[model samples]
Target: MKETLADDLNLLSAFCGVRDLTDLSQNALYQKYQLKKADAFVLFGGSILSGIDVLITAMNNQVATNYLIVGGQGHTTNALRLKINQFYPQIPTKNASEAQMFNAILQLKTGKTADYLEEKSTNSGNNITNLLQLLETHELKKDGLILCQDATMQRRMAATCSKFAPNTTIINYASYKVKVMEKDNQLHFDRKLLGMWEMDQYITLLLGEISRLQNTPSGYGPAGKNFIAPVFIPQDVLAAFYRVAKLFPNKVRTANPAYAKSLEN
Candidate 1:
């Protein structure tokens, strides 16, 4: 017998190990980490709107003094900046969509506020590449960065940053937990779909960055572009979806039957 969408969702919920949303608040984490006044918070991820929301909330709540919103080079980042400017005009902003712009933003945010070298980068690797440029431009010996992004992508970003900027302090602000659902039985499990989605965005970015990097003479070449792929699969993705569904079982169970069926199909 074929399992229903509800079944799949329920299974996913079980795999994810549901945690009470009330207990999952960021307050304790913020307090524990003592993220009172950061030089500038950098929110980088594919979930442009949610990332911006979290960054604005954190700033309003005094979690960070200023913020630099960075993301893959595409419409999302463009739309995000437009929305932010439309909503908050008092805040000074710049479009560091290019590598040079990113370097300028980094220096200004870090209190240097001086002219520096700008390099164009298009993906996570490029973000790191830009950071290296920022470090070189400002002659920074050591620095701390407040990383704000989706919880799913934080680990990979941390690992990448550690490889490139080993001396820099990384303080992560996990924004949200992503859950992936299965089609057959709604089983919830730990998976990489969410991460993969983010990784795909990063991959698209790397493609652009690879083109840019290749144009440079005697550069590292395009090999760095492959670093965006993670070592996980669909199982973890399904589990995460289930876990989130379980948190609101009634909502998952009753949510439009047609939509649920469509998911299975």
Candidate 2:
């Protein structure tokens, strides 16, 4: 059977777990987090350049008076390192952090760097863990913050932040992007590629997120014990995941071994 672009979009959307915040009432139920009370615009660093763009725009727009760029070496960082070295070969990729790479890009773009940078976190869990330590050590307050990351990761980011920093009011500002389209079994962003990931790479990363979203003990977040993602996954989304898994067994196998095993069972 041939899979259509609709199948791919449906699956990718399900896996992304992007929350629809529109339900929150405008006035009291949902009010913009006051930038004045925020400690900083918290940027969760990764290979996603769009996310960084949103962070930069927020900074430039004075959404927050300060900024905290947090990330260490990981898959995303490694990919970003390759992109960074393509232009600046002098900067060594080894032991490179997302913050370091982003700082370089920021300097190249605006001739400046972040107000604070933590370069030891390798995952979302570590992102929050290291950031909390950095904030405390630096004597930063926990009044409020605008959390920014890949749009696909908004739910997980909220979950992690809530678990780790319950006192800090986090306002999520995610990267904006159109849905990934599939043509002849290949995924491509309609606009421009956000970061260093290719079509297949994006598929794999998104599937990995879906695996983590599963409410199994082995998964991450509130669903599992690995991380603290408290977001709920509706039944329709789960059905879409299974449908896509059926279409791309190899990718599901590689990106989410745990979920793959579950599917097999």
Candidate 3:
């Protein structure tokens, strides 16, 4: 039997949790958890300048009195740094944490500073762990929270945060441009329309995150006991994930070795 577009969309929707993404407007956030009631907001770093833009907007809107930027250099630091330099040539990017670079841009754009910077986190998991530790160190309690991350990362971020900080009410806000679409019988993006990252790179990250959402020993969620995320994967979504992997074998295989191995078992 041949697969239809509905099948593909159902799988994609299940994997991406499209409902969550669409519900991330300012109004939705306010409806769920009024920002004014929150002690502070957090920016989980990775996408460099784009992530900073969201942070700055949150700051400008008075989302909260305090804001935290968390991240250390990962795979995309250099590319992000280069983009930062293009806008603010004088601002130093080298040897700076994602928080520091984002702060510099924030200063340039809004003439304000982030309240805290946790520069030790190296990936999504640590982004939560380090920030939680920082909150403890500062004696700050997150009553209500606004977590700003790449749109593609909202699901994982929410899962991890829920597992670790169940008391806090988290309102997720992310960009709408970072999306996955199918065209010409293949997965792709229009670079001219949304030029945040290369199509191949973006797809890789998307698939990698999908792999991490799996409830398996090799996954990063609860099943793996990594304590990073607590995501539930519907069987149909898992099937779609495998189908997509088969469609883009090279990219999916390279993006997540464990996902490939899981299929073998």
Displacement of residue 106 (Cα, Å) in model 2 is 0.4
lDDT at 21 for candidate 1? Answer: 22
lDDT of 3 at 187: 55
Look at candidate 1 and tell me the lDDT of residue 201.
39
lDDT tens digits, residues 1-265, model 1? Answer: 6545444433332322222122212464346554345545566643433444455555555544444544435334454445445544443446545323333333444434222232243444555556556556656533556665444345445445665677666666555544444556433434533222343333233222222222123222224433433223246444444453444443321112221121111
Report the C-alpha lDDT of model 3 over 56-157, residue by residue, as the tens digit: 666666666578887776656676777777766888987998888888877887888889998876666667777888888999977777777665566777
Clashing pairs in 3: none
The best-first sequence of candidates by lDDT reads: 3, 2, 1
Compared with the true structure, all predictions reach lDDT values of: 0.42, 0.64, 0.65
Better of 1 and 2 by TM-score: 2
Candidate no. 3 TM-score: 0.79
Instruction: Provide the TM-score for each candidate, comma-separated.
Output: 0.44, 0.80, 0.79
Model 3 regions more than 4 Å off: 1-28, 86-88, 180-195, 253-265
Tens digits of per-residue lDDT, candidate 2, 1-265, equal 6556456555565446443322212231134442343577777776376556666676666655678888876556666777767755665667767887777777667777889998876677768777888889989876676677776666677677787888777766555545666567666666775454576666666666676766687567564664664666777666666676676666652332221221111
What's the CA error at residue 104 for candidate 1, in Å?
A: 17
